[model samples]
Target: MIDFTKRQKEIMTILSKHEPITAEQIAEMLGVSKGTLRSDLAVLVMTGQIEAKPKVGYYLSKNMQKQKQQDIWNQTFVKDIQGVAITVKGTTTVNDAVISLFLEDVGTLIVVNEHNELEGIVSRKDLLKVTLGNAQATSMPVQLVMTKQPKIYTIEAEKTVFEAAQMMVYYEVDSLPVVKPVENSQALKVIGRITKTNIVKALIEMGSEA
Candidate 1:
């Protein structure tokens, strides 16, 4: 099943009880302005959670809802939504890493060793925590604040996106490093990354096809 945000879930509940509800009604009941929910409504429609008619408003998509569950089960593999991975070296300084983070526009950066082997992960939170009390954050190595190996959560390419989504929800992470086992070696090589946005896009694409 597709993961629904708290507000989305509430909206769905409202629709279930009142079919063909107006967007203005949903927004009013949810205590948010109608304008702010445009994307949410679009996503709901695009993901096949709801059907919309310009004059008729929105209602739960009965037919697509049934197919959605099965689609989630059948579309197995993280590779389906994987995107090119972005990485930083363990030696990268906080200043440089911050610049890279903005330049790349990514939430997390995979840290690698000299051999391009996975070392750890540095997230925006990690950078913020270290920078809060330290004036020398610019010179400090990312390795100093990065979440180290054994603590990082990773997914193999073969794993289902459902499994990856579950991991994200459970771990409260925005993204996951996609890795693959190196033959005859104990190390895993980072190949790609999957984010919540990727999952949403995949769902919308599938819904469109459906």
Candidate 2:
């Protein structure tokens, strides 16, 4: 069953008792503005917990359990679903990076320095653009072809997978490096990586388990 928020439960209860109540009335009883309940009402309607009548008010749906749905990944932690990141030193040759990318079956590689701190990320597209016609460039360091620090997108281990997915879509990235802040420093330490594939696989796994 889908878990309802506290306010949503109260709204459901209000609807049950009132049978059909307007949004303004519900907001007044809850001591909040109707705008505050707008999203909550939308969710309830979409999830089939409640229904709205034109020129009328909202009513609790009769078949609540039939419409029940769970957002399994909404509150899931990135750390729980992330995969081990394939990493290379920034100084690693492009040729070796390519080999690692293929061997690991991953599209991107995390590039770090001796400290194992995140330096940059190199993707197959970046490598392809550089090594397409120029064979000699294969010996070049990955740092040259990598999208450097401050530009690389990363997520915290504690962040929800939903937030990670949002970042991926907004940034137009296939994956994100999961990171943890270093002690007393602004530097980020690579933890793992969350990819579109990882998210999909997790959804499948969670669904199967359920």
Candidate 3:
């Protein structure tokens, strides 16, 4: 399914009951300005879920098959929309970590070894807790405050987006490191990072294709 947003579904329902309704009337019923819904209407029209005419107004499209639009949200892999991971070495100082945080504009940084294997994860909040009251801690290694291996949560590169989303909700995390198994060793390589923002972007992109 296209995973229609609540507003989009409501608009469809209104069209089903009152075919050929104008955008203004739909916006008025929903208590929002027509401009606010322009994008939503455009998406519906582009996806073939709804149709519009110059003099007539809007109506539900009967040609579209809801099921065949299928379940991209559930079947897509983490690698499909994953972004490059912002990385830092475990030996990196807390001061430098802060600099990387701002420079990278990422909430989490994957800690890696010289071989580029996953070692730990340090977040913006972790940096704050370590440097909040004690200025001396800025000189300390980030490993001291990072969530190290065996404790850090990660998602496999091939895992489904559905699984990634479920893990994020259950763990209450904003992002996860995307890892791939290393040959002849148990260590995992940090290939990418997946965040809530990435998931949202994926949904929006896929929704448009529907």
Query: Considering every candidate listed, which one attains the maximal lDDT?
Result: 3
| Error at 122, model 1, angstroms | 0.5
lDDT tens readout by residue for model 1, 137-180? 87999999999988999999888888998999999999999998
**Residue 198 deviation, candidate 3, in Å?**
0.6
Candidate 2: regions farther than 4 A off: 1-71
The local lDDT score (0 to 100) that residue 162 gets in candidate 2 is: 79
TM-score for each model:
0.67, 0.68, 0.68
Better of 1 and 2 by lDDT: 2
Q: After superposing candidate 1, which stretches have Cα over 4 Å from the reference? A: 1-64
Question: Residues 70-106, candidate 2, lDDT per residue (tens digit)?
Answer: 3455658898989998899988999999999999999
lDDT of 3 at 121: 92
